[model samples]
Target: MGLFSILNYLRLKVIVTFIRLIAKWQRRRLRAAQPGPNKKQISIPSRDPGRFIEGYLYTPPETPGSPANKKKPILVNWHGSGFVVPSLGLHDVYCARVARDSGINVLDVDYRKGPEAPFPAAVHDTEDVLKWVAGQGDQFDISRVVVSGFSAGGNLALVAASVLRSSFEELKLQIPMAIAIYPVVDITVEPAQKVVPKPIRPIPAFLARIFNDSYTPNPESRKDPRVSPALADPSSFPGTVVIVTCEGDTLAPESNALAERLKDGKRKVVHKFLEDVGHGFDDFCREGSKAWEQREAAYGLIVHTINEEFGHSG
Candidate 1:
């Protein structure tokens, strides 16, 4: 064969190898889900259907390295399930770490998942949680408030932040800063080739459609600014730390692109890219594991950014 023919064959083999690697990573995640004593199965109190959100609160036994006890920063977290799966009752380790290591009080918001409670519901659920935490945490020293979530949940956090900022400007109260980890910024697919590329595209897109359909009723919700945050005119977003971690060249390019846009609009923003990590990695395991290491790195960057933006003592 000519030299060019051999080069083409080698390139194809490399692409195939990358696909096999992503498949292995997906399998490892599926296996990891079944083993644990951890899921911190705590009950959310006073289950009022209207006011009751289905998640737990984690307060550190000791607020390590805290500057003062004026008010513990409230970190309201939204769980991501492609906006379909229930908050799995599986992310307790993550809740605990956010509270303990970050020295911030954490509230895992169990926003109603899709189908029965579609687009505006998850967005509303998060907004309600913020109001509740602010009102209720008067006792816990909640002088400062912030919101964070993963994937779809991160999208909720941003939408909620946008809405909350509008509320605060109208009400004259403090608008909370936000941390969005691997957030689903733009649901409109960004020209396909911009992110997914020609290879390994099918299932992720298939899974995404399946996921979106389950939670959204009106197909128009897909274009609603509240439903797809990246579609919004981000003139009034809160101080945000946009975190991105990708594996096999996965999600960060979109995240990087979003960060670029946010910066262009002059929003208070920060962005970080960790090496060789994939989506939903934080909820996978604890320390000494590769996933745990990735989660911690992402988590630490968020903490520093929060502290820097809001300051340690709120």
Candidate 2:
């Protein structure tokens, strides 16, 4: 490897180590406050033999008098990590809340990330996870499955919806809808070039560059639909999509553009621009703070959208 590549690799290692430590501490703190949710760690065998995708599954409390044999709808959630941070349980609390509020199973899944597996690896992992979910018809209502994600996970949500469009049909499965919050839709633009009006908590250019380089090393691949779903054909996406973008986020403009393109009259595309917040503003918020309130509102919208799509009253 070139000297620069070697240097970035080392830098990435250091950054990842620090972030992982912080995430570990945060998880412990969150757990101490209260039992966040009733969730269990589960692993699904990947397409590659011996490989596995790890995730936490949150099953909501059963409703009184509900049929014991009834299967519930499932929401497969992917946590945001800029395709670099491999903090699997980062979304534990978020996933728990969604499962309880939406009254469905929420799978906060983990995928292989960059500087290790790189592009197409995470995408393929996502596809494999869906396949596993499709096979669990006895436990979940596969026909009502929904995919949601934050940041890089948000990008995967749409990319999966577009790239796996036909395979899902062949499997006789219905994705029903997808939710992307503050997603990275276009990587063609450099991190420093992205525009944010408020710039409250924009992603640092150095970190973004590190993430981009580690995730998609080939400059040309940045235009590929898998890396930049904004360039993909809108019709390839699922029929219904709910896109949430923070007004102060650098990713908002591109995400908003994709939302607009997906609106073809027949498709149900809801783009909600949360005023004044930056990317991931809902994350790590103190209770009773403004950020916490925004977090509640965003999560509430997610529940409402899922229930509405599944024909359930919320």
Candidate 3:
């Protein structure tokens, strides 16, 4: 057995303990809080090239003072679940809030989860959405497109930006900007191995192992770019906004490192950080935690970050 395997075996007890700790500390999330109302779902064309593509389009609230259709920005959002889980109901509030605050059209892409679909499926779904959005210029009057995601979705957003670079060039498509919220980039580096080191957050090792077992037991597939965007060349990054919560995040350092990498590459980057919030703090807001207000604020930061990336105040 490998050293990691041995470490994992010894750490199994600790892993169980942490899971219980997280479960006990976290209130059972009954339902996600709904944001203010906005545009309802409208059908739109998907890209010609992709496997199992799906999306729900949302528009801004129709008000007497709403922005003109041709002038509103468009946000293409990807949901987070580490490419495995698709429990996006809770995450939808963020997008809805963005639409309300920014008055931008939101395209919530329902990308496939992995294990059955695995690495390439998630990123491929994102790229396909990119194409689909580009094709929707006449429909949504989408002059400015900003890509956004949180955690795993954030990583995919960055990867999509990279993959679309060539596609943008070929199709004469505008190079859309990206907003990555606590993104898990560098798939090549195991988060369990580094961020949540074995003894510290033992559950990550267990979960990652399970993820590996489910997605691709074969070690080779885990190395694929679709599996690990961190393996992608940072020197060639697209325009980005890296939102990180410092001091209490597993992904903060890596995200900060990525921002430096983007700056080094001479690409535009907005690096924002919240000092005291933990990882996924926004989504973790329970019924009556002090963090409820903080969590509520996260959506605003997300919208502002995306609009800022596109140089639009709205």
Per-residue CA lDDT of candidate 3, range 126-193, in tens? 77677777676675644467777887788777777664456665544564577777787665556565
lDDT of 2 by residue, 1-314 (tens): 89987787777777766766776787677642222547888999998999999998888877777777778889898889889877676666678877777778889899998876778899999999999998898889888888889999999988877867668877767787889999999999989999876787788887788788878877799999988989988878887899999888989999999998889986899888888689878767788887788878888888887777764521
- Segments in model 1 whose C-alpha atoms lie over 4 Å from true places: 1-51, 63-69, 140-143, 168-173, 190-194, 197-203, 247-251, 265-267, 285-290, 310-314
Question: Highest lDDT: which candidate?
Answer: 2
Q: Tell me the spans in candidate 2 whose CA falls farther than 4 Å from its real position.
A: 1-37
User: In candidate 3, which residue ranges exceed 4 Å CA deviation?
Assistant: 1-29, 42-52, 62-71, 141-143, 196-203, 287-290, 309-314
TM-score of each: 0.74, 0.91, 0.77
Tens digits of per-residue lDDT for model 1 on 58-157?
A: 7755544654545666677887667766554445666666565566667777787655456777777666666666556554544466777787888887
Show the colliding residue pairs in model 2: none
Angstrom error of the Cα, residue 259, model 3: value is 1.7
What is the full ranking by lDDT, best candidate first?
2, 1, 3
By the TM-score metric, which is better: model 2 or model 3? 2
Candidate with the greatest TM-score versus the true structure: 2
